[model samples]
Target: MAKLDLRGVRKSYGTVEVIKGIDLTVDHGEFCVFVGPSGCGKSTLLRMIAGLESITGGEVAIGEEVVNAIPAADRGLAMVFQSYALYPHMTVRQNLSFGLENIQTPKPQIREKVEAVAKMLQIDMLLDRRPKDLSGGQRQRVAIGRAVVREPNIFLFDEPLSNLDAELRVDMRGEIAALHKRLGNTMVYVTHDQVEAMTMADKIAVLRLGELEQFGRPLDLFNNPANLFVAGFIGSPKMNFLQGRTDADDRNRLILDTGDTIDLPEGRFTQAPGQTVTLGLRPTELQPDPDGALHAHVGAVEQLGSESYLYGTFQNETPVTVHNPGQTTIRPGDKVALTAKSTAMHLFDTETGLTLRG
Candidate 1:
């Protein structure tokens, strides 16, 4: 296993800069995920690490060796693509063994490696089947097996599970996680799905518009985002933001545009009074109460058996969502009051979008 490192890494096309200067490191045996929206440069960054894209500036290193000028094949890394890029004419075993054969590995060695990977991926039975005869999930397993047979220093996955159906995706996720446990190699994964990043990554790198927004443990980004963008992007239902201005009389109070007032804990506001700020509250943090600080008019309700999500607009018509336990009797057009503890609130400077802490 090898640790991957990027120092001032950048990629540009003429005047269009896709990847600004970035510095990151992936420790040996670590499962790191790059997650962001489309065109956020997560894929571009992965390609740069794979040596498939030329770096405009800076160093890409594997372990202690710089590999910015090294060819992809010589980088000693294995990649699993989003598309199951299996040769249609080759059987599963053949596809898995083809790479090894290209390197002129001995026939017996190739067979042993293929058998081991096939069994580990639970695709041993499908070895004789061609890609045309295999299911989507099976084809994906074959693609991963192809990578595993390489025994590279690091494994890179570029949205490998994006093509499968929801159920299949979930199953493959478990399988991939299990594979990582069994083979303990450094892994770098890129995906647009925050859910996948949250569930699969030992650490998550959140990106936006070619810039690294935040990189840390999943729960760190979830509970304590560095900025408004990170806070708004990491959670499932997404954190709700309310426009408000700091109260002049009390530094620990904010007056919302909806005409409601939310009390913050003593000495919570570091920004000056009268400064516009945003109050962020996660869906699960808000609770229904008779006498609550905020009020909303429910517009829609989504019941998913175990929990229900209430979607609505606040008094100011700003969209808000609330998570309720089990089923809720609340219906569309129902006006409800919601309350949350001051400790659960997140304050951000409206202008800079940076968190404002006490």
Candidate 2:
């Protein structure tokens, strides 16, 4: 396996730039995920690394060698695409061995590789079946097995599990994570689903509108988001935002437009009084309090057997979503009071959307 590096990488077409300067590195044997919303240029950036898309500027290096001009075939990387892209007429075994055959691998070596990959992916029994005869998950495993047979320097997965059903996607997510643990190869995966990125990656690069918003460990991005965009994107239930401004009478407090006050840690917030700041609270961080600062009229309550979530509006306008552990008696149209732990609060500059807490 090798390290993957991107130094000020860029892509453009006719005066329009899709990928703004991106400088990132995926260390050897690490699972790195690129996650963002659609139209975020994540797939475009992955294609550039695969040498399928041209770089408008900067460098792409595999290990120590610059591979900007290297063809995809010579880059020693294996890519499993979103589409199965399997040959309809070929059996699973044939699909698994084709890449090695093209590269003139010995017949015995090819057979060994195909057999091992098939067993490793748990598709050994389906080797004789054609693509049309296999299930979606099986077809995907065949595609992944094809990549595994080659033992490339890096593995690139472009939403490889996107086509599977919800249940199977979860199963395959664990399978791929186990595959990485066993092989220990450098892998770069791209997905629009933050859940997938959080569950499967050792490191995550969150992107937006062709630019990298932040890159770090999953929990780091979750706990210490650099800005509003990231704070809202990385969590499952999504963080809540309350419109507020610095206290005119005191720099260490925020006065929400909802007519509530939040005490801030001294030396943590330096914004001038009256400057607009946003308070972010994750749904999970909220708790029931009889005289809590948050006052909301519950609009909807979802009980999923294990837990419940309350949807409501704070002070008649600002929407709030609260996650509660276990089952709850909270019902729609009921008045509820909530409070947030001091550490749960995330403050951001409303103008620039940058985080205000140091």
Candidate 3:
């Protein structure tokens, strides 16, 4: 296995700078995922590690070796792409063995390696099938098998599951996780799917607009996002933002626009009184209460078998969502009173879009 490191990595195409300077580290035998929206320089960053793209400035190291000068073939890493990129005419077995053959591997060793990988991937029966004869999932497995045959120090996957149907994608996700557990090789996977990154990665690196937004464990980013962008980006059904101004009601309370006041400990907002700020509330954080802090008219409801999400407008003209049990009786246009659990509440500055921490 290898440890991959990037130090102030920057990429520019002529006058246009696509990837701003980025610094990241992937420990040996670790599975790190890079995720962000399109044009966020995610794929460009991956290609730089693969030596498919040249670095404008900075260093990429694999296992203590600086690979900025190394050729792609000598990088000691294997890549699986979005497309299967397999040989159309060659059978699965031949495709897996092709790489070893090019490196002049002995015939007996090549046969053993191909058989072992095919068996491990549970594709032993499909070894004789050509690319056209294989299912999408099978073709993906073959692409991965080709990488396995090389036995490289690191594995790189670029949206390898994007082509599959939802069911197939879930199935292959488990398969990839199992593969990683079995091989224990260093892996760097890039995908726009936050679900994939959250589920598959030991650590996730979130990117936005050519910059690294946040890098941490999935739950860490979910619980305490660094900035407002991450606070809104990392969660499902998104957090609700309520426009409100803070004011001193008594010795220790910050009043909201709707006359709802949050009791605070001493010195909570010493410098920002009467400041316009946003109250960040997650759908899961809102609870049903008879004497709740906010009142709203439910506009719509979504039932997801185990839970329900309520879309509504607050009295202060702020849109909000509340998540509750699947058996909730709340319906569209129903009036409801809800309370915000302060422990689950987030506060952000209106001007900078940054979270306010006590």
Clash totals in order: 0, 0, 0
Which segments of candidate 1 are over 4 A away from where they belong? none
What residue runs in model 2 are displaced by over 4 Å at the alpha carbon? none
Candidates in order, TM-scores: namely: 0.98, 0.98, 0.93
TM-score of 1: 0.98
* Pairs in steric clash, model 3: none
Better of 1 and 2 by lDDT: 2
Ranking by lDDT: 2, 1, 3
Model 3: runs farther than 4 Å from truth? Answer: 248-271
Per residue, candidate 2 scores C-alpha lDDT tens digits across 261-309 of: 8787677655778889988999999988998878888999999989999
Candidate 1, residue 107: how far the Cα is off, in Å: 1.1
RMSD per model, one decimal: 1.0, 1.0, 2.2
Error of 1 at 57 (Å): 0.6
Question: How close to the true structure is residue 269 of candidate 3, measured as C-alpha lDDT?
Answer: 37
lDDT of each: 0.92, 0.93, 0.87
